[model samples]
Target chain A: MARLNVNPTRMELLNLKTRTKSAKRGHKLLKDKQDGLMKTFMEIVKEAKSLRKEVEEKLSKAFKNFMQASSMMTPEVLESALLYPSAKVELEVKTKNVMSVYIPYFNLKQEGDILNYGYLQTSGELDISLSAFQELFPSLIKLAEIEKQAERLAAELETTRRRVNALEHKLIPDLEDTLKFITMKLDEAERATKVGTMRVKAMIEAAEAAEAAEAAAAV
Target chain B: MKNNYSIAIVGNKETILGFKALGLKTFNANTTEETVKILFELKKQEIVVDEKTGETKPEYAIIFVTEDLAMGISKDDYKKLSQQALPAIVPVPGSKGATNYGIRRIGQIVEQAVGSDIFKE
Candidate 1:
């Protein structure tokens, strides 16, 4: 029965060596990418954790303030005050690319009842709070964007890690082993050829010496 | 091909427990003989052979083995398992071990970023 055999050329071995080196380098880089991505991800996770807590606190505060405001003012009066015709708010949302990912940006314009309400028409505190909420909206959007980015990076990191491991542990090692096997076989062949050549040269020299001795003896 | 598959880890008790937390099935192999036995059992469980066609049917995607246990298996055994294409033998970092592998990988990525080389387009 014929068994499978591998015959690798010198050039092929060299190519494999280069490939192995490249694979090793690639493996290292992918690992780094994974780590960097993880670092960024962890940072984002931390930020998100803290931001979520802060947002929850702020929202609670805002709700409490709304309750206080509602309790202090009669519902009908407050409704009538808030019923004033205000400016309409128009929002423009756009996307910007960062590190090969798209993130959103928003621009807002206020027109109708939003601009004409009693709070908008008189007291600046509610208007300030409204603007604060508007600012918070962008931050929340940004948080969501970062969270999405972190998730994508985590997945990419995992994939990269797997590829790097495959190359490092399996493919490159296999190539190197094959290359070594071929190189050793080639070296053995060369050694055998060298020994054969040396023997042939010695035999030729011995034959020439014998012929010279025979000639001397004949003379 | 069915994408759903599971990973099982074989190692020390603590390591196995840690892996179990990660939702992986685990078996403990404290001794070298037990490790070999576990590996053999894992290999047996990993693939089912078709009696009629004499073909092997593979199961599982990967199996993580501790480095110590990994040394007990023969190269031929490793080769046989590799040929199956399922249950890729991955030597994961042990519980007490430093994340040198992860750190090295990260370093490589950083190097690639700085050099902008190593990857072919």
Candidate 2:
């Protein structure tokens, strides 16, 4: 693979080295973040599983109670009694930053207070069933929150994981390999120059010795 | 970012085996002594405990334990584990378990209202 022209000079090499180290540090931190997010997601999944179970059970029981109440009373009377006049519940949606990610929160009119209105004056059994449904409402909202957050975090975690893997498994290895190759090439060039200079010096010495022997013979 | 915590499971072969496939670090313990030994090892690594209690704490942000094993553990052990504020200890359904009642219930309501099962396979 074609490596980045990282080390143009000594200063550039130093800078590139620093960047490589920073990239590695960033990679590790992102990996940790990814791991943390996954952990959070797993916890949410577990909670969602259990919460879903609890909510479903309560809802089912409430539904059964409603069915019984409806059957006992006249259908017309039960319809009028069980009718929950829809409240104009307006939600002000806003976003908050959690761990650098923006998450939405629904600001309801009554933030944490339960608003009991339509079914308060109903029959005893019907009232109890409605209260049960009311009790399960917060958990149902919570389940929605957990599931949403889990989905967002899971997506972010997957992206971070991919980036970390790329840096660790591909980019860093390629850069190091290129640096090694260049260093080896430079060393080989230097060695060849030294060998050539020694050969020249040896040739000069041999020529001088032959000339000296010729002069001695002449004398 | 600050601490590195790990989840280690100590249970019968099948229990830990399923968790391993879920990317959890598990320790199989056939005996109580082995369970304690593995728990101690995880503690030393600062992976399981909060560095105070020697018990098997919920690290990894969540711990899954079988209902049978959860009953065997003491209340004090649970209290100490709770202190870490780590992952919640959840009881997973074993093989041959029915659909989670909560999920099924919610799914049923949605299915009825919309004429489609939201959680259907």
Candidate 3:
């Protein structure tokens, strides 16, 4: 820790003491913030992981069905089949602040069923895949929300942790070092002054005694 | 706060149809350039805030990209896009099998914060 370059005066010492107090207070607050951010970040990470696993499983299953359905039909026919979407998945995003991080929440308004394609040449697997996707859409959106939350929270947590570390390791110690150095300097100066005054008094008394002895010898 | 953001998916005709059936706006991206272009376009949306309610929101909330297409986005762009507030870009399984890109990307995020690859063990 580097000593702060300030004049070693009583005024400077008092100012340093106040600064050290506030730095410690700020450090405590930052440490608490770090803990709070960590706790929130952990919760969000766990939720994101589970939700991600579920979404991945559902997506792969849906993709499998899609693969099968696409294999049975020609490219042109498959392209023409799902060209136009039947229903709409209405969405509105809302966000909540978690430890200063804005995490989004999606409100889905599910409308009619997805049945725009005629049931003629389409394979049953296509229907199954489309329905699977339809059902999983909301979950997908939920996954997005949680994952994004995790990302944002993690970032905030990182910054808070770094700040806490700087206070705990660097700034606080530096302040303490500066405070100690100033107090020591002030104490040394005080002692030096005391010694100098005592010597002066002794010399003056010695001179007076010499004059008194001179007077006695003259008498 | 309330927002008018929507989710989107970008991929080929076959891969995106499933998402379209679910009512997400699906974009057909034949090449990596097309996919990246679409993502940039989505990111270009300006955030709108209501003067009366003080509620703020953006247009695109999330964009799901197929892994094959996601692979085309440079690491820099991917990092930049993921680090933003709105429009969380995520990758999912397409017609092919699992790629684990999404899991790995999220793992990177976790590692960046926690200072360890806790996702693996």
Candidate 4:
């Protein structure tokens, strides 16, 4: 619907042709990028789903034990029992590019026993909950990592989709239209110039013929 | 000073108190506002590292929250947080029981990524 305002000249036509070619190439590349981003995003989504399901199941089991422990023991005792955690975790985070999106990687290093409290003071329920949490460390980290990846991929996918749409729907069409307009204008100009040159030639030939005829008559 | 990387648990005092025994840092946020604020804080809570490439990256790896508190977060905030890879915010059932919020979120993610709810629970 929109076009560049410029005189339709050979130079302009040449430039527009090159621009159209580049735009088409750019469109194809962007479309490929969008497809790649979608593929990656879907993979991450699948992984995140399974990971979340497993982690939720385990965590719920742990919470159930915590509930039982709380019911059996006094609130004050439960609080005192888990006052200081027995385990220490060191987490290292890094990012890697998946398609141009940088997604995070979480690595957890856990040290020492997760059961930090004295057995005499804690119930079996407490033990179960603590162990369940300990077992969940890796899943939790993995969930974090995958979820971030999904987010990044999703974001990239959106951007790529926007670009692809712009090229497919807007830029490419505009360029093509502009190219057509310029070519039509240039052809019309060429036709008009050719017609004018033909008319001049015919007139010159007619005048020469008349002069020659006059010379013969004079002779 | 204790460790460069630590896991933080945010939720009700009753629900997350047990996590303290594991040496994890715990924050009690009873209200939605407080929970969102804590999530934001945790999100922003990262250690900046100077890479050899001269780029700085902030690192804070994992965060766990009770499902009830996680639900308290607004949809937009939850979407933003869940999509992030760092400071992974995991939702555990509180003393009450499993709310299935975590699973549902995953299902939603599947739908968003694949354009269909194929991974329905």
- TM score of chain A per candidate: 0.59, 0.73, 0.94, 0.88
| CAPRI accuracy category, model 3 | medium
- Model 4: residue B67 alpha-carbon error in angstroms: 3.3
lDDT (CA) per prediction: 0.53, 0.51, 0.81, 0.76
DockQ of 2: 0.03
Listed for each candidate, the true contacts retained, as a fraction, are 0.00, 0.04, 0.60, 0.57
User: How far in Å is the alpha carbon of B76 misplaced in model 2?
Assistant: 47
- What is the lDDT for B55 in model 2? 49
Best candidate, lDDT: 3
Which ten-residue region of model 1 chain B has the weakest summed lDDT? B112-121
Q: Tens digits of per-residue lDDT for model 2 on A113-194?
A: 2222344444466555545545554454455455445445544655676788898888777667666665666677789999
Better of 2 and 4 by DockQ: 4
- Order of quality (TM-score): 3, 4, 2, 1
Candidate 2 chain B: minimum summed lDDT over ten consecutive residues — where?
Answer: B90-99
Model 3 chain B poorest 10 in a row by lDDT: B1-10
Q: What does the lDDT come to for candidate 4?
A: 0.76
How large is the interface RMSD of candidate 2?
19.0
lDDT tens digits by residue: candidate 2, B50-117: 44665452234334443345445554654455333333343333222323533543343334323355
> Which candidate ranks first by TM-score, i.e. highest?
3
Q: After superposing candidate 3, which stretches have Cα over 4 Å from the reference?
A: B30-33, B46-56
